[model samples]
Target: MTPFVIVAPAGAGRVRLLRTGDDGLPFTGPDGSGLFGAAAAVTVEGSDLARTVAVLEQAHPRWVWDDTSRWYPSLLAAGVRVERCVDLRLSHAILRHSTLTQDSELAMSLPGVFTSVAQVGVPAPASAASIHTPAPHSTLFDDLDDLDELAPSSSAGFGATDPRHSDRIPRVNGTGGTGDTDGPELDAVTDETPELAGRDHSTEDPEPDTLEIAEFRRQRDAIRTATDPSRIALLVAAESAGSLVAAEMQHAGLPWSAALHDDLLTRLLGPRPPAPGIRPARLEELLASIRTLLDDPTVNPDSPAELVKSLRRAGLNVSSTRSWELKNVDHPAIPPLLEYKKLARLLTANGWNWVDTWVREGRFHPNYIPGGVVTGRWASEGGGALQLPKQVRSAVVADPGWKLVVADAAQLEPRILAALAGDRAMAAAGRDRDLYDGIVASGAVDTRAHAKVGMLGAMYGGTTGESGRMLPRLARAYPAAIKFVEDAARVGEAGAVVTTRLGRTSPRPSDAWQDVQDEAGADNATEAARSRARSAARSWGRFTRNFVVQGTAAEWALCWISAIRRRLWLLDASTLAPTARGGAAPTAPTTPTAPATDLRLEQRPHLAFFLHDEVMVHTPAHLAEAVAEELRDAAREAGRLIFGDAPVQFPVTVAIVDSYDQAK
Candidate 1:
């Protein structure tokens, strides 16, 4: 049989077999519209290339050439004597002479590239032929030499059941070993507890395989250390400054306060603390401090001397000495002082007076309240919890025998923006992988860097006019997505609070706001100001539109959390042991499980840290992979539940690593 070649344009409706020319190669299709424009050609090489070509000719109707080497492997596996050949022109020169010289580079790169191309452009029909002849090799991956660098070794099998084997499950490091200083003995504590089921519980503890364990320890320790009463005090002070600013704005008849405070306390303190006794003089002092902070560029951390000098350009006279006084003063210095008092009182009631006595077994489990901010976000409690200080992350060390699993979502908000907007162009941009890259490809913007800045500004209510202007352009380019935000904004302007798919409601507008709007009709300067206040009120309403998307995103986060928690509980005790061969080393167990050790859903993996759309968990090393899988599955399920698997798609990026910082 003469060797032949098959070629198909990317979006072509059919595949065709062409007679090999004198050069013994297929001709490149003409460059134009239709299949020729959409796709390239396919090339096959091997001992029996002619047989492989015959098989392809038989299956021509269903075949598509997404790339040059798409079907080479599958044909070879089906008893056809063909192999994928790498076109030297396309191969990296440096890699061509390296350890990969003998491998079929075309076989390696084709699948990923083809899968990507197929998703865009157009869909092709599946082959209708019923050729079922099995190849001499039982496995499709018979050409192990071609993918030796990519494949797992005998000692690194992924689903090995032996306690001494590393490949019992998918591990971040490929080796089952968790690079934790503490050994696998911690599996016992995790295994015996029903709450920690779905976790690997092998008796043979493994040593650290990667820096992931150390990173996790660092993050865990950081969380533990930050929870110290003093640290919490500092955070509360900063957070209170934000709150006090809102309150002062409210008192001064500014409408922003209601929006800023919107259900924040209810989410944080749980039903809100009883209205505190308001000392008019004390409240006045706190308000003044906040005003000073907002007005004075010198007092703000991001302010530069030049910027401070420029504050007058914006029509504000703030003194440097006033900024210094606010920072230097302790008890009497405005909002921080009042916040400290309130936080101190709460700590006392919780029996956390002394820092040493407050922590439980060197672990501090902070409460992560979802939708805590009116913007549909999360807030933390207990330790310097919600907005963690970077300096303190080092304190989140691992427990004596355990490790931490840090995972996060990448480009979450922008992806959410794509879903909400239903902009096919934007959605198509994201379909290929990176959102920023997609934007660049669209040619709607100049560069990926600018696209990033514009998208972020649009979501956060970009103050600079540049972002606002660019946003309309983006909306014009992708009407569906832009309309999503516009519709939400319209609802918010009508004074309606948006709700999540799961029924979590946005805080209702305060009655004071209603009064202000009602009084705007009166003929007075106050009424004119009221009209301006109403305009300002629209910002929060805008926030609510974003809040719905953001809050629902939070719900997805919790779903991932719940899934990981459950999967960890299902792992058997024996599966977590160190592999006997080139396997993960075993670490010594540090914390012994007591008879009363009870793992609750809330306690299984300590949620030590959270930022916007990501979370960090500290668990026994044996349960790390299970936790990672659960996180991914849960996120997907949550998306389906919230958006219904329809016009919108929600995808999550999750990675399990030993260290908290490494996860980032």
Candidate 2:
């Protein structure tokens, strides 16, 4: 296959193209000037962009670009898609931070041009929400969604197996963080720098092309010499493919019903506020009811401090305004308070303001930040895509002739744990069955709830409450599974790093963490100091404990998405609409090969949304079943590729729905 490199907007509305070979060194022809070892330099402008891409597709050359977010959207808009690409920015982040590449000079250097993409790779710390909702009397529930209640928290060190946390730390190195917008992060270069025979690749600064090509070459070499080249190659390819999916999904945009969303908001929040910074009628009524129950009209429920004081005055004896805390209180005020909190969340998080900003031209185009979480789960920039409230899910409606096929892997993290540990008991429990149910059958716990809690505790270092109580039972039932995480925890407690299956390494403890450890060992350390040290150690242990399983699970998700994208393209596109209706559960295929599916990979039947283990594909209504089957097949393919003959199965629960609410 011919290898191609594309540089976007090489001035004058033209895109620069270069073709290379298997060696990856620039192509050099007999009469070539060899400015950058190019056999030829061609600029294709105007409508020829798509034509050029279409012609290049025939050769099937691997596209090389700085970032997919910047380049692929335009191609996708112009009705062109490529099979393979080399994402220099994404690969740079992986190679730069990878322990496997640490010995190399390029890897040993500080943050460079290539290092700007680190935010997309590493998970942010827990601090505050990047975008805070202005909810009055907001509780912990305000930040969580239905998924949070049903699944583990996605943040490292959190009391959950699949930790996905984000705390915005002010970044100083120009641009990067979980919140960084999608674009070409590389500096523009009009020409290539002179090739230096003895140049230090680790230098602080270099020309954009020089740094880009050097880092790309270094990463390629690192993977070639990797401990497991095949796995590393799979990982980089999957990661880069993820980049493509992210951009393409954004370009396609999630089909949203602005009218329906407006209706939902009006019914719930009592219409839009008459003016900016004003509460809607429904919210105001809830607030009034809350104050009446407290008998303090002067009290402000939005102010946590004022509300807590008011509740104490009302003789409620509540500790805080959080729903969970108030749930324990039997006061009549609790009900209204809960109602107020719920509506407040809806109005603030996904209300009219959100609709105006996010939903554009009947589509919600969320900016996907691939590899954003520390554990490798993706994040979003704007539109609160990750925090899709169930109340507003009704607005995620399919177009008139299309349907949304939503699929989520059943008990994904636990199954991932089973595969990672190669635990026969765990795998046997999870294979082709509900893992928690299988655990209950094994006599590990008395109930499904206990089984779930025990496994979560095992992976996330949950040694308190019901989770803590069930750990011993889990250990006895699945020794290998429990020991896998236990060993990782032990390593973390010793301040050692752990690597995911595909080699994404967890960061080491911070300097403060090390100081705490050292102080605990010093003779001058007080009991409080030792206590603090132990607490921090346990915290770090929780992170590493879940890191391997969570990170590996992320790898499985990437592979799953990549496979689905490829599979969606292979299906035959039909102009005829299938028999299934758009707004309900799609009908089963009448024949082995359903006729006139109207699912076109080049146009429709594309992925619209993904969150952790769940994916929503927007496809022609007729082809919903086919897309669902393809999703299932891709999941199986991802499992086989990632774990080979491992007994564990990644079970996907798929639904063909007209709106996202129907999927649930």
Candidate 3:
């Protein structure tokens, strides 16, 4: 079977498919070059694309396409799902900036279609309005009209047993503190690398089929000739598979109960207001109490300025109304004020308006952007999917005969550091138990708190207070792991670049950053200038210090989901009848057979949601254990694939429950 089939747009509302050899390169003729057009291509109408794809998919070819988001959604809407793909857009973004491919022509050449292609075409993060609006293009998500395809399936499976593997961290409020600054705000050099900035990728609609074919070949050649060919190849494949997974998750959508969500909101914050811009009953009550206690009846609790004035008037010395800052205040109004803020946050982030816009027909579809963060972590376009608040997690209910298999990799970043650095000591510390506990047992630190604080400091450049004091012992116990991040930090301080385990390169420091460092080194440099330069250097150091581990962890996650994707497909296939597979039936029947329905995404165990180190699978009740095993096996396989023979164990805390909140 051919390894790849190139899918490209053809004129007059049709698409062309071109088969490629096992190496993913175009077919070569007598002259040793690929054929240009008609001789090697098959064109089909736009409406028939899904059927043709379904047929060709039987060969298990990797669908080579320009952008997965642009092409895959419609196919999913038509009840077709591909096993794998070569997302050229995502691949170009990784290769061009990657140090491993720096010597390749694609990396050295001036930015052109590939650079702009990576930039200009991607969607901006989702906003409230955009989620409800129709997609701008004709061939995009507009065809996703069959909402029933996303409905829960029948419960014909066996009962599932709950298995608790590990404990989970509680839901904390307000985006946990940043290590270096202890707050959200941090001053750091902006990355405006010339290779990544400012260019128009505007091109003729449906680039020539030959161009895509040649581009895919170029990318393959670049990967094949890289210094670490096998590792880079694995990285690219995993990254591309992540693109497929992201799209599939969006299409499948997470099972959500709007009724449950509304109940939770109403019980916590009072019923929804009768009209827009009006406070709910509970909020109004809280506001009245807060205003009366502060002796400022007209002060708007929602307005920070007014609230701060009122807090001071109430004899509390508070600088800002941030929950953390207000938590220490002992005034009677403080309690109601904090409650008001919490409930207000619920109303704003995931309240009634959120449900109306993001959730449709019992499923919440957030536009997930793969490799959205520079460190390769995903970011959501709008629906704030990455930040699904714990306050509303109870609303993430599984379908009646299905369960939500939620799993979080315990201490993912630290374990990643062990594998990346090949530090046997560090790896052993996390081998079969909680990494922090192992650290304590190994005498690296006195307590789990010290172990965690020390490790966090090591990775995040924390050098003050308790974290600073604990670092000496941690470094003494795990020199290799400590030295690895320290070296990365040093390189970053010097304005050099750093690369992840699988070749995702860190963007170089901005020209402004270099200018600041240069100014500080001048013969007559002022003390203030030197101090500013040192602070700037440390900030960038912190970024690079964490980049290597975080990026590699992201790669591991990609591989984990990719492996789970294939495994779940096999599981789904195993349970379905022959005729039900891909909606195919026997040409001639000896006996009557049930009418086959296309195996939709919701019909089988599918990835419902994914954050950096956690994933939730919505699966049939009986397959919960099997899906849980698949997740564990995939995680182990991910580690082996990325860091061969490394002693580090990536243990996941799996919880199979009926609701997402219950798992946590």
Candidate 2 residue lDDT tens string, 164-268: 211111111211111122322111111242221221122121224444455556766666555434445556777888998898888878989999999999888
Which residue runs of candidate 1 sit more than 4 Å off their true CA positions?
A: 1-360, 368-371, 374-376, 522-530, 576-612, 646-658
Task: Please give, for residues 96-136, the per-residue lDDT of candidate 3 as tens digits.
Answer: 77766667766766666657644322211110000000111
Each candidate: what lDDT? 0.38, 0.68, 0.71
Off by over 4 Å in 3: 22-25, 28-38, 116-210, 313-315, 572-598
lDDT of 1 at 548: 49
Candidate 2 global TM-score: 0.81
Span of ten consecutive residues with least summed lDDT in model 1? 125-134
Count of clashes, each model: 49, 9, 3
Please provide, for model 1 over 1-664, each residue's C-alpha lDDT reduced to its tens digit, 9 standing for 90 to 100.
1222333222233223332221223322233221112222322233333343433333121121222234333342342322222111111211111111113232222232222321221111110100011111111111111111232222221110211111110101211111111322211222233332332222221222112222222222221222121111111222222222112111111001121122333332344333444323333344446446555433322234543454434454545424454354442333443453443344333311223333443444344433345443555444435544332344445543445666666577766666544355776777737777777788767787777877776666664766765786676666665555566565566555544322233444556766666677567648577766678567765775576467546545544443343344444433333222113322433242322122222224434455666656555556666666665665555444333332334455655554344444
Model 3 local distance difference test score: 0.71
Kindly report which residue pairs in candidate 3 clash with one another: 125-381, 126-381, 126-382
Error of 1 at 431 (Å): 2.3
**Residue-level error in angstroms, candidate 2, position 343:** 0.6
